[model samples]
Target: MPTTAAESQFDELGSLYEDVVDWPFRRDIELPAVLHSLGDLTRSDVLDFGCGAGLYTRLLAGQGARRVVGYDESEGMLREARHREAKEQRGIEYVSQLTPALAHRFDVVLSVYVLPYVASRDGLRQMCASMARMLRPGGRLLALPLHPDYDPHSDYYTAYGFRLVSESPHVEGSPVRLELRVRGVEADVTAYYWSRGALEEALHGAGFGPVFWAAPWPPGLARIEDAPTVQRAYLRRPHAAMLDCRLARAAE
Candidate 1:
């Protein structure tokens, strides 16, 4: 069995999960913010941890990353990625294992929206350790975890094409149900929420420090037809957050 159970939740999702990116919040804000945080990808070796249909894999390669690896445990999701690669022929590698040759290999590990799937502290630690191992010392890990401060009222983000139904009196490990109704694509998913302290501990335990969470910055309103209102509401308490940190050296 895998160390974490997240893959199970997404196994049947296949390519459907990839379509969520078209939602206004992700397209106008989340995607741009993350790509900007990466600075430049020119010839960078990147690992798309929990790649999920190679969305970032394709984007990273398009951004000039020399090589990109899409790693995920869901065979169904990998099937979708592989199928796309067969047609798109992007030269990206999709794998289910974190092999020895992959250790300390990537310059950046883009773990978009993966943290919320961890079911336990140990799973979170394992996920972080795996990400750290894939990253060279001083390489960056750009993780987009479900926002720790997401409005518990659930419907607070209806305008963003999704709603979060959190457990009442939620705490670390509580289930946060995610309902997606974006661009005519609908799906129901369950994710876990970890407190900020627990998240910090997991990252620290995995040899990542000085973690910085970024606020959602919508690059522009060009895409969203109704920008001002959605921007104000979503940015006020976004459903997901960006985290930037580096694998610390042994001495540091």
Candidate 2:
């Protein structure tokens, strides 16, 4: 049977997880520095939104997050996350919904490279709004998304004329890599690419302010390795609204 749109998306994501799992940690990099600067995770409630394979959730728990929740839309990914949790004996919870049931606000929320798949403007807005509401006042949200400027579909030897320059703007023309398995079944994946302005506008429209942006080169790994072209955005929620009331107001 063919994969559903949701399944196809995750099938691609699962293929890329292997590359990311050994990254930063395997190379001893400073990828977490910018996020940690936003807030102290020690004994703080944290949620790893779209926490594929629960790698970052484990990281946060190991770093002493009071509670770490991992939520994703992929069952295969969640199964792997649960297996890892059991093997590591970690206390992170994995849910298969975009927004799981949580009564109270969290101290910090972080999402790594999961926003672009959110192709719908309304859905994306709802996600941002949900994240903001999931936080306590002054809580922070740090997310990384694909650089909007990078084109992922255009082939290298296209109709347009090509010339040599001092340097190339990309490692791989397409930052995302799609891998298929033995039976021609697609499996793992990784994605990176985003523009600064588009990200800012998205967050601002979502009601988040005081954004901090950074493009830190891979701390210990070669820049060309893994097509290291990621952008990080740090946004803090100065205030939060009641979920029902916010929706009601928006509907007014």
Candidate 3:
């Protein structure tokens, strides 16, 4: 993977990266949505793209995945992941990039909060193609990227410890920079934007079928009338969007 400004930013984050994504919104809402989309993992071969700190990779291993390999471009992030793997002995494999030998080897390829780091449409297309190649026939790709409808200016929920310093017009392929504060440390992060149409086209071009958008709130949310006010508010304006896709059965 080519080095980008975002990759360098993540490298600097390193071990501190875990704290940035440890908010309740991720644990209570985003993770559940991802797991729901994943359905079952028993004996499945899984690939975690951009698997920072091996958080989800370890989780998938715990869920009975037969084989789990995590790939990330940032060495600093991988260092943290390696540290945890050595300590926990979860049998997870971490690599910097996918090699050609591993093509079509995974039953499921999951990426979370990674697509926005792609700085160009061509980069996103290549990413989709690589993800497609990673999956076997009928394999699924579950991705969670920043929502196209996200309003950097909104104050609906501000407890996540980040603020938008500046934003470009919400046009396709624009850039958005954010100022993040975690554990009394501050940093600037940059991410690119993709309209729904742009993302759909990239997926389809890479041999993925129609993309399905999953709701932020799970089905069981309807039964919980006593849900916390913050939870309900977060659901109303989710910062992230779930994209569920699958490799075509006839894909080469």
Candidate 4:
């Protein structure tokens, strides 16, 4: 399968990368929004594509997905994910290679923050195609790509507990540096953004139907005590957005 140019960035990151998931924006907002968007998973089979550290993979199992597979190209991430799986004893599968049996084997494919790593427009479409091939005819894909309208200024998002720094000429595929800021967490990851049209075009070319974009929401369900002031600012300028779409059914 074709891989992203930045795939190796997480290879040696291992356990340290897990801390990024605890960033407040993800804990209170992104996590709930994604799970709510997935709806019921009572008996569904899920594929957590680019499942670094198995954060959501573990949660999917807790949410009652019958079979959860955490697939990643990074051994560093997988090591941490597998360790957690062993320690927690969730029947989740971790794999770096896609076998023939996995094709069209999932009811849902969920990706978080994976899209930004694709190095090119064609690479993005290829990534989508790979995801499509793993789904059933009418399966759903919920991905959290960099919001096409994300603030380019570094400090615009610091109040949300992270920083985004990108150079001028914010065109398609412009590389952005994401810095995670928590008391003990340290992360600086590179990401590339695509325009709305580019995202739609790629998904459609890969056999997905119309895309639905969701803005970041405050944690109304969990209400995790995040200040109203910060919530309002981040809601209005979330650096990431929910992208919900589905693969075309066979009859189409």
TM-scores of the candidates are 0.92, 0.63, 0.92, 0.92
Per-residue lDDT, model 4, residue 246, is 86
Question: Considering only N, C-alpha and C atoms within 3 Å, which residue pairs clash in candidate 3?
Answer: none
Tell me how far candidate 1 lies from the true structure as C-alpha RMSD in angstroms: 2.9
lDDT of 1 by residue, 1-252 (tens): 134556777888876777877777788788888888887899689999988888889999889998999999888899999999999998999999988888888899999888898888888887888888888888988999988888888788888788899765248898888897866777788889987888889898889879998776865544434566657778777888888888886212
Global local distance difference test of model 2:
0.52
Candidates in order have lDDT scores of: 0.83, 0.52, 0.80, 0.84
Residue-by-residue lDDT tens digits, candidate 4, 61-178: 9999989999999888999999988999999999998777899999999998898899899899888888888998889999989888877788987776678888842589888887
Stretches > 4 Å off in candidate 3: 1-5, 154-157, 223-226, 249-252
Model 1 per-residue lDDT at 134: 83
TM-score attained by model 2: 0.63
**How accurate locally is residue 252 in candidate 2, as Cα lDDT from 0 to 100?**
6
Give the per-residue lDDT of model 3 (tens digit) for 115-145: 8888888888888888888899989998887
Error of 2 at 3 (Å): 15
- Model 1, TM vs. native: 0.92
Top-lDDT structure, candidate number: 4
